[model samples]
Target chain A: MKKLFAMLTVIALMLGLLAGCASDPKPTKPAGTQGTQAPTGGSGGTAGSEGPSEDKAPIRVGVLAPLTGTMAEFGKTYEVAMSMAAEKVNAEGGINGHELVLEFEDSKGDQNQSAELASKFADDDGIVAILGDFSSGCAMAAAPICDEEEIVLFSPTASNAAFAASSKWAFQIAGLASYEGSYAATYEVGKYAGAHDVAVFYMNTDFGASIVENFRPAAEEAGMNIVFCEGYSDTETDFSALITKAQAANPDHVLIVDQTSISNVINQIRGIGWDVPITMLGPSTSQQVIDLCGENCEDILTTVSVYYSEEDPEAYAFAQEFADRAGFGATVMAGFAYDGVIILSEAIAACGDNITRAAIRDNLAKTDGTYLTGPIKFSEDGDIIRSYLICQIVDGKYVIRCGYDYANE
Target chain B: MSKIKAFVGKHRSLMLTAALVFAIVFPLFGFKKSMVRIFCRILMYFTLAGSLNITNGYSGQTSLGHAGFYCIGAYVMAILTTRFQISFWPVLLLSGIGAAVAGLIISVPTLRLKGIYLSIITLGASEVIRIIALNWEGVTGGSFGIKDIPRPTFFGFTFDSPLKFYYLFLGVAVIFLLISYRLIHSRVGRSWMSIRENELAAKSLGVRTAPAKMMNFAYGAFWAGIIGGIYAVYVQYIDSAVFSLDEGFNIMSMIIIGGQGTLIGPIVGSIVVNGLTELLRPIGVWRFVMYAALIIVMMWFRPQGLMGESNSILAGAKIKMRKAGKTGGKKEAIS
Candidate 1:
């Protein structure tokens, strides 16, 4: 009977495999040189070309993200946004008709894979620009490659200040780690309990470490003492021990920095019945986090890249479209990634067909228009000049309460 | 009929010759540039799997730290090429040596443990290396990584293009595979099998178990390092996080799912698993779940894996004939 059941299972699996193979729409192959020539900005050597008369070729832009594995959902949303922009621009006519084709590789959320893809893009793809790498670490690893290759790379969502500060090619769309830290630090620590003391629990990784480095300085300057500062690994599921430590400290407010599976930590903290105001950084307070925390997520404070609830029609529409595509379930990083592609495409269109790595770099440098998030401009190092929004969860949604500009300009 | 069979057996080299000819000609005539990259990935993984095969497949030891060695090799090559401005040929050799030494160190503590314990130790070791890579800002460049590791230049010849790199990787992979194949067929391989099958008996046979085990670890580490160094030169960048525990898991999985302990296993595994991964990516997140399920299922049924220790057709034939005789049924082989 067991053998029979196993045979049946095998048959079922085989059928499923066959169905999957049959469903994939074969990737469209690039036609030969002659086919590509139609409406193409012709190479300068050719007459009556659509593109500018530059000796160089059309710039290739490479996009790397976690196309598969844990971060696949976020990656797909970004790909969709990028595809839409690429399609809309190419339809209206690409940069001086030279055309911009965005190539993608799955980093699988592994730093090694990201580095490998970065190297491959630099070596094989002849890419002139790069836009992606969702995590700060991944982007940090790839930035030097871009600098070496002289490729213009703009990261959409990596928030680590140390990462951005390390390389010249790394321009980030997300606010700096220091920006998030200051935003949290400047908040009235004792507003809820009428006390000015705060406690901190953070992941032991660089993301967590950077927040502490920045937040402590700002908090001290604001005349508030950090009553307790503790760290934990992202892999630990139970926060009971850490929560007890924080509760013992008996501070008026608490700060946490965790990027993976934060729902458990939230629940554990709540289970301990500690009701002090909480502020967390990086990949916290998403819909998924709320789903995992349920009522525990209510009134929780967090920071993210966009404020979709704002009145800007374009931003609202973009958010609505993304929410609709994600079945009304989109993460903040997805929004940032979507806008990043749009910004990149817009810059490419601005550059026209004479697009080189240098041109793309220049286009990004001079960006003045507002994207879905807000007015976007790049500093010399490629970081977006925008403020982060402090949001609170009311009725299980991140409500943008205020904006904090971390650039301090 | 017996004489014909004997003649065929006597000249089995024909099959190998045909396979070699096909491998050489196939990429040149029909495959495009993109296809060539995919094929190159297949070869790279194959070389990686070959290294894993020696440690895990042939020796029956599970290592979750192979990618750590790979990273060590890559960083060494990158530092030598870019910071020291050394040539690729010398740098490549140094990378292998460096990785071999690291493997020796990792294996010493790990050789006493087995199964999950060994896996955890290797995983921890790899993670420790990665953290050091991230935090050691002076030499490792922290997260920014080392960049512009020079491409190969040999005897007035510069290999600058993808096609050139592909050939270079292929040549090096083939050499490593040949070395691996010879090692597996040698007395050392028999010692590994003896230890794997019966450790107590092998010890009684004067196998010098610790040295044998360490040698297996060192050799695996050596080749992984060489492959990694080549990768740095190929990609021209080095990041510490790239050598994390996740990479180690992936290479181990490739070896496991492919036929561990066999030449064709890694090659077949890389294509089947990596290709399916890319193909299923449109489904997005569920693809990983599917892959994990596949590994689980394969383990449940064919614990020996797609290709077992004995790589030859003769070994397979021997098994099939025995099973057929016992069951009194038709024998079938699937590729």
Candidate 2:
């Protein structure tokens, strides 16, 4: 009886494994068409298509996001914002009469998984383009595969200077770290805050390293001295020792470079009763920092590639809808993701009926228009350089202190 | 099923040849490039898990830091190949020797320890290696990692695609298995097994237990390092983040599920685990939960693993015999 039971269990497990593999790839439909009927000759339909038809095949794009690891927050943001963009595109008569579909594969923020998923997407004949893998390291890992496969590897927020340059098929929408870092050092720390000696605490990753590498030369050129610089691992949570070391330097200003742990650093700095002016380079206009740090975030300075203010109706609408879905205020990272989808769809629309991988690449390379994140034009290296807005946390909210043209002034 | 197992046991050599032929021609079946990559991953892990089995399975030494040795080999190849522009063929051997040396150094301190204590020391040692790699900016590139690692070439043919790299991994895996098979059947293998059965008994029998254990560790670490070098070139990128405690645990889990103290255990483990990874891709985060549940089930039903030696000390068969003897004594007394 025990032997028979064991055999039966083995059979059941084998069946479960087969069932898991047998299921078709799950592609997310446009959010607008999930429950409601398809629009027929409506106001949104007038932009491109005559009407939404069920017979036309949907254009699919594979999205590799780290939905289950340390970077899950950013991955979820990409999922929500990209789906929102797909919904908007479909509601506006789809991309050249074909409904836009997104197949989000969770990479868990691992470079191996990212590269494997990229290969899977590249092998599929249905998928025309690939988006995301979150970090620069993961994106760079997948870059070789996408380059060899001749498929478009478009990243929403890979700011590494070497990432886009690694592959001809690779393109990133995030402003280069070199440009952002220099602007932060020269403007935020040097000119705006009038701080001479700066202590920098950056994450130990490609993104953090590149920023500091560029920040040093720019800070020195601006006549500011770097008293101390240190990097901590991404998984590190305790900032007491790091903060103490930085405090020992007794710098006039402190700059923190990281996305997930900005609030932890700020709270720790204030917890130790050190009140040096803190300016951050990453985590642009994040409400989580304010929520987590509370009063400790007061008068904290930062730079953003884009800012959605109540004064702009279009940008404000996006912010409101994003907040309703994401359960937090929208940041510039979300803006980049939303813009990424729309930009890719526009390139797809330009392909007309003969849309191949090469055609998508050609059309995307020629992208030189205004986006949700302001004017975006890919340089020869396939990344963009955008102007910045100086933002300050006042009364527990992000308030823009300078316009996009602040660097020029 | 028993009949089939008996038949296979009778013609073991024939079955082995047939399986080897199938593996060699697998990529030529016109499978998708992604599928080929999955097979490559399986073969890579086959060697990795098999190496771990040398210490944890054969010698009864529990190690949870195989990834530290793996990290050493990968970094050795990446640094030498990228910076010095050395040929990959030589670096591959150097990487293995490097990891073997690291294993020997680690074994020195852990010679007197056993079970969980040795495991804890290995775990700490793995973290120390990763921390050093992360902070050593000059040679290791700090957190930026080493990138653009050149692909290995044989004469003029570059291992550029998944199909080509599949052969490289297969070649290494086959060589490892052949050498391990010879080693496991030799007198040295008998001494290692005796130590696993009882270190005190082995020592009384004039077997050098300490050197045997150290050599076993070095042998295991050597194979891990070789595979790590292959992995560095395969991915063309090396970073400190790749070799974490989680990675060490991942390799260990394969041995647990496939069965330890057996030659074919790791191969079976690799297929089941890597196959499940692809099959469960649609399930998202729940796949990890499923994997944990599968391990729990394996432990409950077959603690020695699928291919682990059932009669070995690691399987607790001696304890079962002792209990049965005690029960029989009680029955005789009652009679």
Give the candidate number with the greatest lDDT: 2
lDDT against the true structure, each candidate: 0.68, 0.84
lDDT of 2 by residue, B124-240 (tens): 999999988888989988777888999999999999999999999999999998998888788788788887888999999999999999999999999999998999999987788
- Give candidate 1's whole-model lDDT: 0.68
TM-score (chain A only) of candidate 2 = 0.90
Q: For model 1 chain A, where is the 10-residue window of minimal lDDT?
A: A36-45
**TM-score to native of every candidate shown:** 0.73, 0.93
In model 1, which residue pairs have backbone atoms overlapping below 3 Å? Answer: A41-A51, A112-B242, A171-A382, B259-B265
User: Fraction of native Cα contacts kept in each candidate?
Assistant: 0.07, 0.34
User: How close to the true structure is residue B64 of candidate 2, measured as C-alpha lDDT?
Assistant: 97
Per-residue alpha-carbon lDDT of model 2 for A1-409, expressed as tens digits?
A: 3234444654565465445434433443442332111122111122233344557877888888887878887887787778778778987878877888777777888888899999989988889999897888889889889998999999989888888888889999889998888999889888899999999999888788888999999999999999999998888999899899889989999999987788889999999899899999755468788899999999999998887888888888998888887778788888999999999999999999998999999999999999888998889878989899898989997799888888788
Q: Can you tell me which runs of candidate 2 are displaced by over 4 Å?
A: A1-51, B317-335
